[model samples]
Target: MSDTTQMETGRFALNSLKMLLVVGILTLVANSIGPETGFRAGFVESIPGMGLIVLIGLVALLLGRAIPLDLPAFAYAMIIAFALALPFSPVQGPFLGYVERVDFLATTTPILAYAGLSIGLQTGRMKEVSWKLVVVAVFVFFGTYFGSALIAQAVLSAQGLI
Candidate 1:
């Protein structure tokens, strides 16, 4: 392809990514409403929590980009969010109170949508793996399931709650 054509394609791809992210952000913001509180009141209340999540995720992404790490952006974003949400983190002070009423079911919509988009982009490579992909997927599923169950059982046993 010509240089001009390549540049145009790159521009188009960047614009497309920006558009998708904007839509996802908007969807997450709007869907922040809780079922228990109804739309109007919950919509107003959820904004701060949603804002904090997006800010933290954006900061994480920026930090990841600044560093010379091989990890994916989402991994860093998750780690930053998780760390901030930890009990000892002073950063989570006000946000924790709002967290309980935050509509996580609504938040999953864009997250799953992006996950689908990511998987869809790898279709050809997935087809190359074929049945082996299924085997790997099954192993991943069982590993996660049983691993979590084992941890939970251990923790519960230690606590004498099980």
Candidate 2:
């Protein structure tokens, strides 16, 4: 379309790529410093897995922008990741092999930190909301936590793993 619109689109894409790269690096560092392995060993071993994860995120971001729907980029990423990891999928073997190198806790660490920072920054706005909303959010969080624990316990018991 217009030259200005094209320039803005290019700028947006470049910024998105930069943000994703930062996230990838942060995630790699988190994974590297985990308790199970030394930093050098973990960092070297997890490079391929982390790279694939970031690539999937980049593809999902592009897909989200290209599609007309209002779905978020993370939703697209989840779908693509899930599909790749499915047992019957063609890429399942290599996908799982690479993905398994990255610990689950490593990924959640950065995400949780970001979420906490976001909430901290929004505290002023949160104060403007009703107390009832805070109460509801507490209950929702509690229920989700308890429900997940119960499900995990049941599954572990059924599998004779606990």
Best by lDDT: 2
Model 1 misplaced regions, further than 4 Å: 1-25, 29-34, 37-41, 69-93, 98-101, 151-161
What's the TM for model 1?
A: 0.58
**lDDT (tens digit, per residue) of candidate 2 on 7-126:** 455676777778877887888798888778433237777888888988888888877777878888899999999999998999999988888878777888889999998898788898
TM-scores for every predicted model: 0.58, 0.71
Q: Estimate the overall C-alpha local distance difference test score of candidate 1.
A: 0.66
Q: Relative to the unseen true structure, what is the C-alpha lDDT of residue 6 in candidate 1, on a scale of 0 to 100?
A: 39
lDDT (Cα) of model 2: 0.83
Global lDDT of each candidate: 0.66, 0.83
Worst 10 residues of 1 by lDDT: 1-10
